[model samples]
Target: MTQLETAMAILMKVFDQYAAADGKTSSLSKAEVKTLLEKELPQLIKQAKNKEDVDKLIKSLDFNGDAEVDFEEFVVLVAALTCSCHGRQGKK
Candidate 1:
């Protein structure tokens, strides 16, 4: 697969890996999102200036107000994070 394809696959796999905790394959609950962040994104979590930032971030990602993040929502989070990271790297 191409690099973008591989990245997309990895995203799905990671989301699935975390989403399985709640027995729902379609979306992630608050607890699942917390776990995914704490486990898969320890570094980013650490970068958060305050603990509430994590909660706020998750809340913001729930664009549909469904209280769960679907695959499309997850992709938006990933894309935003990627853009933020890319922007930071370009500064150095």
Candidate 2:
């Protein structure tokens, strides 16, 4: 997949699984996304206008926001930003 795909995957994975206190069964609520943005990806999540923006970002990455993303999703978003910080790079 491409870098955009990787990043989307990461965001989706976090929202779909890791972001939730209850585990991977639901999406991150708007408030939770804001908190995470303030902490984890302060820059990206900061620009988010509203739930719509979050939904857009999420769907853009998921390409449909099917509910979950995997490691590949992470790569797409990070790669899109050219963060190059994640050790995984891509794949797996």
Q: Who wins the lDDT comparison? A: 1
Q: What local lDDT does model 1 show for residue 81?
A: 85
lDDT of 1 by residue, 9-52 (tens): 99999999888988998999999999999998899899999979
User: Best candidate, TM-score-wise?
Assistant: 1
What TM-score goes with each of the models?
0.90, 0.47
**Model 1: how far residue 77 lies from native, Å:** 0.4
Model 2 per-residue lDDT tens digits across residues 7-48:
666666665554465464444444454455567787676677
Each prediction's Cα lDDT score?
0.92, 0.58
- In the order shown, what is each candidate's alpha-carbon RMSD? 2.9, 8.6
Where does candidate 1 clash, by residue pair? none
Model 1 has how many clashing residue pairs? 0
Q: Candidate 1: what lDDT?
A: 0.92
